[model samples]
Target chain A: DTAVSQTPKYLVTQMGNDKSIKCEQNLGHDTMYWYKQDSKKFLKIMFSYNNKELIINETVPNRFSPKSPDKAHLNLHINSLELGDSAVYFCASSQWGGGAGMETQYFGPGTRLLVL
Target chain B: EDQVTQSPEALRLQEGESSSLNCSYTVSGLRGLFWYRQDPGKGPEFLFTLYSAGEEKEKERLKATLTKKESFLHITAPKPEDSATYLCAVCGTSGSRLTFGEGTQLTVNP
Candidate 1:
């Protein structure tokens, strides 16, 4: 079974369109995160939710929003997506309360988003 | 600013060749250093975690060693299948957020 999974592995839409990507984790982890990998393969953090509580929010654009319904799911919604928004999105989960050594983050397969 | 730098953006080697990738970091109060292997079109897969300086971890033909300033991932007698992008990330003591490097792309030819 996959520990972390994301819906709609590939998304292709026109510019100015709105879209959402869903992520779910079955590892019973307390923390979930969203990352965006740009064309240069630079992975950067966008948001993080711990036990349904917002913990870390990077300097992402206000157009991007992340919502966590519970500890097991985190969804990202983008408003008026732009051409520059094209990138691969990744979902990851980890046991926050566990010690640093024991709480290695596990990542999902990633969702490729293309805004033309 | 906290950052992680990886050397040799890309490397090509013959099968059975040995090499090492470097990851240097500048973070406050290091919690753990992580090594991950990623194939194209896939998320990174965790390989090892180094909690402190002088820590080492090994699996198969890969071995990871950590120092106060940097970390090294050594590949011994690598095969074609061992080729992939190796990423290094640092989990800070605060917030447990990971800062990732640009990653080193490795290719092994049979």
Candidate 2:
């Protein structure tokens, strides 16, 4: 079974168009995250949700919003996307706790987004 | 601010050749260090996590070790299938987010 999955493996839209990417994890993890990987292959965390609670919000612009309906699903919605929004968006999940090896994250295949 | 820097942006090795990748980091309070392998057109796959200095973990032909300021991933007798971009990340005590390094791309030829 696919532990973590994402929808719309590829997305190409206009400069002003809005788009959303869906992510789901069946690992029964308590924390889910959204990450952006730029063309340089630098991965950065954008947002994180633990049990449906917003926990981590990076320096990302307000155009990017992450919503977690439950523990298993986290979705990202971008409003009025621009050319700079082109990158690979990845969704990850992990069971967070105060112990060793508890925070290991598993990532989904990723959504390749390109804004013209 | 927490940061991670990986060395040798890219490496090419013949099959059965051994080498190591480096990940240097600076964080407020270290929580854990992670190693992952990413193949072309795919997300990163988790490999190992090192919680503290002097810690070591191994699997198959890969072994990871951590120290006070950096970590190393050693590959022994690597096969062509072991070729991928290796990523290093660190999670500090200040937040639940992970700071990742620009990965080191490894190319192993048969």
List the candidates' TM-scores in order: 0.95, 0.96
Docking level of model 2: medium
Largest lDDT belongs to which candidate?
Answer: 2
lDDT of 2 by residue, A57-79 (tens): 88999999999999999999999
DockQ of candidate 1 relative to the true structure = 0.60
Each candidate's DockQ: 0.60, 0.59
TM-score of chain A of each: 0.94, 0.95
Per-residue lDDT tens digits for candidate 1, residues A15-78, read: 9999999999999999999999998789988988889998878998999999999999999999
Residue A47 displacement in candidate 2 (angstroms): 0.6
Among these predictions, the greatest TM-score belongs to 2
Question: Candidate 2, what DockQ?
Answer: 0.59
Provide a comma-separated list of chain B TM-scores, one per candidate: 0.97, 0.98
- Please give, as one word, the docking class of candidate 1: medium
lDDT of each: 0.92, 0.93
For model 1, the superposed segments whose C-alpha errors exceed 4 Å read A98-102
User: For each candidate, C-alpha RMSD in Å?
Assistant: 1.6, 1.6
